[model samples]
Target: MDPYLLSRAVSELGELLRVNSAMLVTAESCTGGLLASTLTDTPGSSDWFAGSVVAYSNSVKQNVLGVPESVLEQHGAVSEACVLAMADGVIRTLGADYSVAISGVAGPSGGSPDKPVGTVWMAWAWPGGSRARLYNFQGSRDQVKHQSVVAAINGLLGAVR
Candidate 1:
């Protein structure tokens, strides 16, 4: 929850969206709507910020954002497959030029042998291509969520170039 870093992220996202003249949409899980909230916090955000879907539940991810049921079943919410689907789904569903998606277990609990707490998967999708990344951040739940949002914004900025 570093305000300075968050400010930089918001400024960078604003600049990127302004340069591209593109709209961005988000599909979020572990970070909830933090990514969306951060974008909308900027003034004149309506110029490029499209919308967001807080698809915290698998059913919402499948039904609202159009994430594939198979993807969810096979990879769960925090996997690369699911994050990619979420990114693509939000872009298509929201008619956005760029989209970012995130899912993770940001908690003191929910850690498994394979996926531990603070395990986050993020994806960015645009017209021609898409990419996803997995991060194992170390912190409290709030801190993990904050880091995920920062990463999501930075990933979106990176996606444009």
Candidate 2:
């Protein structure tokens, strides 16, 4: 990811959340802690940034974020069901007004017939509503992660409005 674009996204998201007095939590997998790190890059992010859970493993996803084992078994980690569960779980566990969850296969490997590399599943959840989307990006591992982070942040911005 370009440092400038990342900085811009973080700045924009920070301002929006600050104005709305909203708290956010993120559950990340393929992007690891990148999204969390990006958001925290902003000064005074503590106002609207609650915390993040890097649930890169299924055990952590289940134990920390409360993602159900059944969901993961049924839908895999990169499916809409799993992402939605992850988003809702993070909101419940972290006590954030909004939460975003990302799970993806961003690599030169892990490509199946149905799900190729760069296949990402992102979900956002608030008090009363939640939504998930599937995105297939084209690029290297770094690029896929970058695109996923941008999409996750942009989704939060849209949800605030």
Candidate 3:
């Protein structure tokens, strides 16, 4: 979650999308709009970054992103299945060439035995492919969020390339 490395990754992602003439969007839950904000921090990001959806509530995840109610019920937000659905939903909703979704519990309090604090799930979707991963980040809430955004952009670089 080093600031320099994070900025470098975001710059790289913007370059890749611009070079490919592709647009990227995001769906965020635990990270809120941090991912989108980071991308937009790039000077020319509007050319590549489409928009972001902060689907922090289950209602938004279901209504806005089209994440299935069943997925939430079965696996909860911090699960692979939920992230996959969220990624697909954002891509479809935003009509972007690529999409990244993050859902997690970045907590100092909201930890359960099953999905503890700092447990995060992320997914990236591009064209006909997608990837999902679980992360257990350490440190404060902001650190987990920064790490999530970094992992998400890195994941997009992997998929888009």
Candidate 4:
């Protein structure tokens, strides 16, 4: 992620969560723990940041976050269904008031005829509600991950508002 954009998003998210007295958790895959790292960069972020799970592997997603094995087999990892499950699972596993999950094909070589490279799916969950989306970002591996992180943060900000 760009330094400027990461700083802005982290600052905004910190303010929002502080105002709402809420905590956040992240479930990351393609972007690894970039979201968590970005958020934790802010001082006193621990006040509202609960925890994060870098579920980069399907096994971690299933065992740690409780994403159903069937869901992974049926829809693959970067699907709407998978991300929704991840969001719900992370919120429950980490016991956070709200959470975001990210899964994507961020690569220069993972492109498929259908899913393609840069295909990303993200989900945000709050009490009694959840939302998921798919994004086909165009870039190199690092760029794709950067875009996914930014979009995930933006989605959470929008969801809370």
Clash pairs detected, candidate 1: none
Cα-based lDDT at residue 36, candidate 2 = 93
Residue-wise lDDT of candidate 3 within 84-155, one digit each (tens)? 999999999989999999999998878899988899999999888888999999889998898888888889
Alpha-carbon RMSD, each predicted model: 1.2, 1.4, 0.9, 1.2
Ranking by TM-score: 3, 4, 1, 2
- What's the TM-score of every candidate structure? 0.95, 0.94, 0.97, 0.95
Clashing pairs in 2: none
Show model 3 residue runs off by greater than 4 Å.
Answer: none
Give the 10-residue window scoring lowest on summed lDDT in candidate 4: 1-10
Q: How does candidate 4 fare on TM-score?
A: 0.95
Candidate 2 residue-wise lDDT, 20-138, digit = tens: 88899999999999999888988989999999999999999999888889988988999999899899989888898999999999998988988999999999998789999999999
lDDT tens string, model 4, 1-161? 67887788788888898899999999999999988988898999999999899999999999999999999999999899999999999998989888999999998887788899999999999988998999999989989988988898898888777
What's the distance in Å from true for residue 40, model 3? 0.4
Candidate 1 vs candidate 4: the TM-score winner is 4
Model 4 alpha-carbon miss at residue 129, Å: 0.5
